[model samples]
Target: MSRSVFSISRLASSCRSRLLELLFPPACVVCGEALDRPTPAAFCRACLHEFAEFHPPYCPGCGATVPQPLAAGKTCGHCGGGKTRYDLAVSLGPYEGLLREQLLRAKKPTGEQVAVALAHRLLQQHSEQLQAADIDVVCPVPMHWRRRLRRMTNSPSTMASVIAQQLGVPLASGLLVRRRYTLPQFQLSPTDRLTNVRSAFRVAAGHRLQSAHVLLVDDILTTGATVTQCSRALRHGGAARVTVAAVARSYSDR
Candidate 1:
C-alpha cells in the first residue's frame, strides 16, 4: 500500500475509535472507574498496580508460596518426590483479593480487556524468567470445545497470545487439547482432583512440539492437577521442557 493510503487508513481508524468512545464511554474493568481515553486495555492505573507479583519464598516447582523461605533448589511438599510434570512455575501472585477478582472476570467474554491487560502486566514482570527458560513454544491449557463455546472466551489462551507475541516465540495454541470435560478441579478433593484430570489431555494429532521448551499458560493453579496432566501430554508429545505460567496459585484444598 502507498504511504498516502496507509495514512488515510490510520486516520480513519482513529476517528472510528473516537466515535465509539463518545457513544459508550470506557470504564476500568476492575474498579469501574471511567477511562480518560480509549485504549485496548480498559484498566485504570490504580487497579493495574493492584495486580502485584507473588514474592519469593514460593516453591520453585509450582509457584506456590511457602510459609518460610527455603534453599535455592527446594521444592514444596506438593511438588516433591517427582509428582509434577512441568519443570517449574511462575505466576502473578497468590489467588486472593484483587487477583482473584480479576481472574474470575477474565474467564468471562466481557473481560477480554482485563485478560489482555493482565497478560501485558505478566510479561512486564516475568519476562526475565520466561525468557531465561529458552522457551521454544507457547501453549495454553486447552478448554473443551463445548465449554469454550459456552463461556465465549478462554483466559489462558488470551494470556498465551500476548506473551508469545512479546517474546517473539511461536504459539502452538492448539498443541495440547483437553480430551474430555471434567468437573471443575476446585469442586473435588485433592485426591479426586488428580483423578478428574488424569489422562484428560493429549497432544492434538498432526501437531507436535519439536523437543521444545514450552511455557504453558493458564489462569490459575491450585492442586496443579490440570496443568500436570497438560504438561504430561506436552512431554509425551515432544516438549523437552515444560514451565508453567499462571495468573495465580491457590492452596484451596488446604
Candidate 2:
C-alpha cells in the first residue's frame, strides 16, 4: 500500500541521517564542541547562551546600548547627532562574545550555515517589532559586484531573504545598487567612514520605491555611515520610510 511505502521511505531517510552523523560528528560552529546530534542551528547550548541580546534601555533610533539610564522620550547622543538617515534601527546584539565570533565566521565561504542560524535567531527575537513596522519591502544593503564575486556570498542578502520569507514580504534585492567599491569601513575613522560611503549607493533605475516602507538589512552596524548612505539613496528613490536591521552592533568606536 502507499502508506506502507511512505513509512519505509521515512525510515530509510532517518537511517541515512544517523549513518552520516556517525561518520562525521557534528560540532558547534562557535566553539567546535561536539554535539550529541546534528542540528541546523549549528551552535551548542553553552555557546548559544553566550550570545547577548540587546534589550531595553537601548537607543531606539540606532540600537546602540546606552551606558547610562535616560528618561523616557530622550534620545541617545548618537541619534541626536543626526548622522543616520534611517528612521529606526535595531540589532540582535552588541558585537562581542560568541555573537562576534559567529559574525566573523559568517563572512567566509564555510559560514553560510552559521549565517542562516543567526538570521533565524534575529527573526525570533525581533519578529514582533518587525511586524509592527508594517514594512512593504525588504532590501539588503548591496555590495559591489566585484566584492561580492570575491566573497562568493553576501551576508546581508542572505539574511534579508530569510527575513522576507518569514515576514511574507517582497524582497527587492536589486532596488539599491552599490556603484563604487570602497575600503572596509572599520579601518576608517568615523568622519572618514562617512566620506567613504557618501554617494556610493544608487537606486536601480525604473525601480519604483515611492511611498514604500523598506526594511534595510545588513550584517553588522559599526558607525552607521554605510547604512546612512544607503538610506539616503533609498529615500532619493522615493522610499517613504527606511528601517535598518543588523545581526550585530559594534561598540568599538562608540
Candidate whose lDDT is highest: 2
Query: What is candidate 2's lDDT per residue for 73-167, written digit by digit as tens?
Result: 55477556443578778888878877988888888888887888788788877888899999999999999888889998888888898899889
Model 2 per-residue lDDT at 209: 86
| TM-scores for the candidates | 0.82, 0.82
Give the worst 10-residue stretch by lDDT in candidate 1. Answer: 78-87
Local accuracy of candidate 1 as per-residue lDDT tens digits, 9-53: 999999998898888898876777998875555578887667665
lDDT of 1: 0.83
How many clashes in candidate 2? Answer: 0
Deviation in angstroms for 102 in model 1? 1.5
TM-score (C-alpha) between model 2 and the true structure: 0.82
